[model samples]
Target: MTEGLSLWSLGLAVIVVGALWIYGVNRTMMTVPPEAQKLSPDSNRWSKELMRETYERVKKNPIDIKKHLPPKLDRRYIVVGGSGLVGGDIVAHLLARGQSPEGIRIVDFAPLRRPDILGVASNVDVIKTDITSPNSVKAAFSKPWPASVAGLPLTVYHTAAVIRPGERSLQTYDRVARVNVGGTANVLAGAKEAGADIFIATSSSSVAVKPMKFWKWPLPSLASNYVQVFNEDDFDQPLKAHDEFFGNYARAKAEAERLVCAANQEGFRTGVVRPGNGIFGDVENDVTFGPTLKAGDIVSWTPHVSQNWISSRNVSIAHLQFEAALNPSVRAVPPPCAGRPLLVTDPCPPITFRDFYSTVSTLSVTPVTETYPPPVLMLILAYAIEGWANLIINFPILTKLFGWKEPTGDLAMLQPAVFTVSAYTICDDSRARKSVEEGGIGYTGVTDTLTGFCEQMAVWNARVERGEAGPLKGKGAAAPVVA
Candidate 1:
């Protein structure tokens, strides 16, 4: 009787645990928004008829550069969000092109926070401005340029944006819209008021991508599972299609880009540059592949999904080229890229996620290739980890106890989806390359870029050791690492 009672107790405990697990996964862990379910690759919503009509109507006619001369370079530059990775790189490139540091002004909310990753001299004005407030933007722009160049034409690069504000809710969505959409409008207003001649808004390739639930679809071997490479002419997906189609970040960027292009006029030429899966250069002590390289740590992520990555350095160069072509300098030539958003990517074909991770390992002296979990299992864990991370980030004591270091306290990012979601989207930058007057973006060499990126990581790791960067609180925290 005692033996029987013990057996019954064990069975009951097992049943209770199984029931709780199912409930947790279904009710608490799943984070996929309901808007995601409305998407169907085969739906008439994505009709070919609509694509063909858009192709014919929205297609840009060939631009004749011979008829138009390049603009002059006698212009002052304003780099909004210049403290960021892309903006910092743009500042560096502008300096390398012989633009005086005094000629450029960087406006950012955290002007003094970011390190001089690109070695921008202190002479470049770092104005603290809240882009969300028009009054703030006006004040920043009101700061006069040097007396010698006071009357020069103004070229403004508005690259400031906000994303993943700790939680996925209506409030977070509103914040994103305020900064990305409303802030962009303010920048346009400020530029026009300031008599700016040229404006370029930084956008993302995600504007053209749709979120896909890959686990429910066909297996990895199916070609249909992979996203088709998007071209400039594929404007079928409207900006307001659905929030989950590309999430709030992409949606806001799409809206902002539309505004910039619409704001283009006879005197003020506005354009957008959409960079694909930008990674590999960041001055902020955020999570990246650098830590894994240092530890020779093997990680796990989704495999076989295709992704296209563009170097931040290359993106900076593209922005400068577009600005130069519009500045009317004797050295500048009329580039075919203007008045519309152009996709930027490496000339090479998209690579599988597994291959990308392996390439990083290969590039690093301490190699660390990633393993893969079955798709369904990986998705479940992704949902669970996101929930766990969100909970832990709130309680500092809990995080310290478990050994996790999130520099930014608000760590409720859709972290796991980087491997699963981003891997499936691809953007083609052929138009950007062909559109440039020089025939190419000049930074098409991926190998060289990767080598340079690895070197930068080495330097970054050294800084982390010296306590100059990374999360300040957590001394020895460990979290589940992913791509």
Candidate 2:
């Protein structure tokens, strides 16, 4: 009886000490705003590790044989948002599959916070340039790939955007749009100039038929998120900017989609990938979709329903699949991939908001406090805890030698690694063909394709938790948990 009691006490103590350790680190960690969070020192160091991991997964082309194209167009690949969550996974998959890193180019506005990009510095050519700028976009296209690639044998994988705050005003919208829509235009312009053969674009699944739930949320309290669509005539009402956050991102993306579909060239062809939400990994530590708050009902999602989720890694794989289709050298996947909209998501049926959250709940050792901690103090407290815990875990000798308290906190963010939802949207990927045939993008009937994403999200999340990502160096990771 005494031994059992002692064991229980030890467990409790370990848990308590763990909590204290994280609390100390988090408290001191400096925080950057959502819009401007850059890579920290520790995170940067870790990013190098991620760079290595990413190169391992992404170096190989998923398509072993080019479907029909010649050898010159087969090897070179470029992903614009390679540092972002979804883009990051695509890079990882490529490296893991054994694509030559020297042949890959990773271009993003901001660097990644994970270690994948950091480790592959030697293998990859990381470029920081604004694709919206004609010169910049042209330069990227004109750049030479591997020695084997034709004089300008480059394949374009575009995912750059000037979204969010950048879309807040008409001026902002134009600026942002210039990057997405204008950038694509330039990519084509340069592709033509450089004799590049194929391009694959990351298009949003935000249908023009309906305003997204993100645009509808907090209608009465917060600024409206819905804005004017490119095809406003289709909507029941005239398109207007309803959301402050909606300023220009939607319009730009909408316009960009229009531009890509109209991409008819003599030598080159294009493919578009529309992935529904649930694409969470880590970059900004953001889960844009959640229960009832900001998710889509891919199928029969009523206002009573929650949002949909997708694993960014899976989305990355799907996008990579599209990339493989573009390679002109080896036989890839199904032919006729160019100029097609492939909807990539999950395979599970929908679930209620509550059930979704219950499945992804994590073990948080920190006591929930009602009082709000000041932002500055919060940073201090968070880092203090994180530092102490890392020290204890990485240096166990210190634990025994110094008699340190064992940390037991939300360090196990094992659960809810991806976005946790109480409810989600349902979708149908099978109908996407019809939408494409109709010169539009959507699933057949009313079945939203996002329904498939939920099931895959679990598997992708599991893989992410299996490793400790190091994207940005120098900085401690803010809890990936939703605030």
Candidate 3:
């Protein structure tokens, strides 16, 4: 009789634990704050016809970024990471505004791959240099410019950084810190050595993101703290603890930003531009929309999460605006914009992940598809993946013992850190928009999020119609867990 009672007790305990697990997952996943709902666009607004019309309209009358381009200065340029999304756009804008190609030098780890900049590649010098190595950076910057523009003052735009949003472990800090932190220091030293009068580093708004706490006891009716408003206010305060940031990437960037801002002096003006989350506007290599478009399908767990986005072009514009603000000839002595970080974002309100997925699905001729999984389930999987990754990283013998390979590509990106950044984040650009005289970057976004998405889709659709690319085949890769 006692043995039977014990068996019954074990069964009851199992049932209770299972029931509690289900309840916690469902409650956490389903609890969206009222403010988040207000921030998200209505589901009714994301119809196929609407997205199609927007695509067509944008194709007919595309955004004219040239109109918003800052007037070109005569200064010679050294754009580190110039082949990347933001740096590429900076190079294109400089050329579009009558800056001579000879006057621009691209110091990047990667060769020029951007189609837009490839046309001018021959005229501009491309110096492949790794910023992590102080010697490499110094040599790249020390290389003599063409005699024609050698006399012009130099402005350096440092835009390179390894982006691993899902990584939060201090164990993995060395990898990112080598590039984001050490590289920034190397680039800053090299620029000063090269006699650069102005330096602008590309920073991320993720620096201000606080980690999300979803498993609090007595689970609240709403996840109010998950919704955050981001600006430059954090710059005024002491840097938070590394764990306080969403991940290692943000922590490294925060340090890099401090280094760049503190380097500002009477003649060597320095600043940082913090682009809002979800930077898109590239046909390839964009972290947000491009991955879904490339895969031709998305497995989404964030349909209701809303976050601000910024376009690469607009980010580039902010950099140039900062340069103008700090230019000795353009502004008064001790420029108000120098020695600070400015946050920038699209001019529109935040949009839900569903909105982004729907726009791509509706407009892509490649037949994009989406599946919405439970957010809590994905969160659980992220933790598991992170554990396995850390295990393999910490113990190389385990791989040989169990034939285990480290996660790569999208799978490697799945981690608990992603959840913090993927939460509802709305960035405000008002501080950056204030006039330069008032201690701001005097920034403006040329294209809003929807328009930017529509414009990119139109380009892809045109390429498909012209038979330049695919109606691709096979199952698409898994969508990224974080934008």
Candidate 4:
């Protein structure tokens, strides 16, 4: 009886200590920095009137992505992942600059879904190719170009990638590696075999963002690594261990970037563009804005978080600029932009999560609601979810024994790694903005954050007005809580 009582006492003590530890960590991390607070949006910025006026302005003077496009090159182009966000924009920019539709091809796993891209889809070649399958990639590349642009040099833009920001388990690394790492190698080989002269792959700025350490016991302070300034400095160092990256997605991207850079040669030039976190601008299914607009109501824990965002249009511009810099016809000698990664972001200061919610809430004709739970509680729940997920993933037999199923959608994304990536992140794109002659890509962003968000919201609002907007469907209906 005494031993039973002692065991119960021990269990209760353990629970109490765990609870206290979580509370302490939460208290420490909840203290917002004065500098970050200054970046938060003013309450007035959320006013409906201001947002309506901004929407009006955006509709009146829509961002002219064409004005920022590079001069149309006399070359045939192949954009891998061209049906998606950045790749789709690259195709649009190419067509906008008068590149013949017959001169361009889109090789992607997904079909052409974007309405804007669909309008011109008939004119361009759209091939459904799975990058993970070497044979599929080879066949896609081997497909003949039309006779009109057959003689032109080939420039390939590889923008396809599988994104899972919340997953950090090594056991699940293969899920992302197949596409991000192995698939990149497949595409690289295919591009070379196709006699491509210029190759550029889309990478992520999160490669430089380290994981946050939130369990500092003795020190009553926030995680020292919570605030990050991302640039290309990490590229100069050796790749970090998988554990060092924010999640599997970032680690895979880093490896892919390395392969692309290493493949740079005298005849074939290669480069990478790492777009900042929160890639948006596609009204249908972009990671940032589209999901929120679709959901209409959001539950968030990142009101205090601040990070950089990049529009698809700006990311596309950077790719074309990189291509121009690497083009042998444009440069007399080997350019500095070759075999390097350039960071790109919207031309605006990093804004708090509140700013994003405010913009959507105010601009949308459909009533949008946002609920913020205590961040500490969310963090605790995230750890629990991750632990449960890891158990299910590491031991598949549990499914047979207990009928356990893997988490999906938003629940699957509630892992601890989400907090790390969602932390305050600032991206510096000075190198990319430098002139090509000065050893940079000469990238100039087309729209600022507010204008870009306003433009997208304007489109969605117009859709709602036209009675075309409908409830979001499919597994992608819920937006991941991570930025």
lDDT by residue (1-483, candidate 3, tens digit) is 999999999999989976676577556665567777777657534577777777888989987778999898989999999999999999999998989999998999898886556886667889999899999999999998889899999999999999988889899998899999999999999999999989999999999999987665455333435889878999999999988999999999999999999999988999999999878877766776566766676777777778888889999999999999899876659667789999999988888888888888778877777777777778888889999999998999998998998788888888888888888888988988998878887788998888899988887777778886544542545443343
Angstrom error at residue 447, model 1? 6.4
TM-scores for every candidate against the unseen true structure = 0.70, 0.53, 0.94, 0.93
> Could you tell me the TM-score of candidate 4?
0.93
By TM-score: ranked, best first:
3, 4, 1, 2
Clash total of candidate 3: 0
Better candidate by TM-score, 1 or 3: 3
- Write the residue-wise lDDT of candidate 4 on 1-483 in tens digits: 999999999999999987787777777566666666565444424465766787899899887777778899999999999999999989988999999999999999998889767886668888999999999999999998889999999999999999987899899998999999999999999999999989999999999999988887655465668777779999999899989999999999999999999999988999999999878877786866666777766778877778888888899999998998998997758798899999999888887777789888877777667877777788888888888888888898999999997777887888889888778788889999898877698888988887888888888888878877777532335553443
User: Candidate 3 clashing pairs?
Assistant: none
lDDT of 1 by residue, 1-483 (tens): 999999999999989976555444333223222222222121312133433343333224322222222232667889999888778877766765567787889999976444644355467889999998999999999888888778877899988888652233343467688999999999899989988979998988877765544432223222222354576664434555644534667777878888998887667777788887645565353345545554444445444445566666667766876675555443244344557787887555554455445444544333354655444455565566566755665666876787865434223443443432444566667767663564333223233233334445455545666776544322123343455
Off by over 4 Å in 4: 1-20, 35-50, 472-483
Residues 373-416 of candidate 2: C-alpha lDDT, one tens digit per residue: 33234333434654664566668898689788643423321111
**Residue 251 lDDT (model 3):** 97
Clashes of 4: 0
Candidate 1 at residue 442, lDDT?
29
The alpha-carbon RMSD values of the candidates against the true structure, listed in the order shown, are 11.5, 17.7, 2.2, 2.9
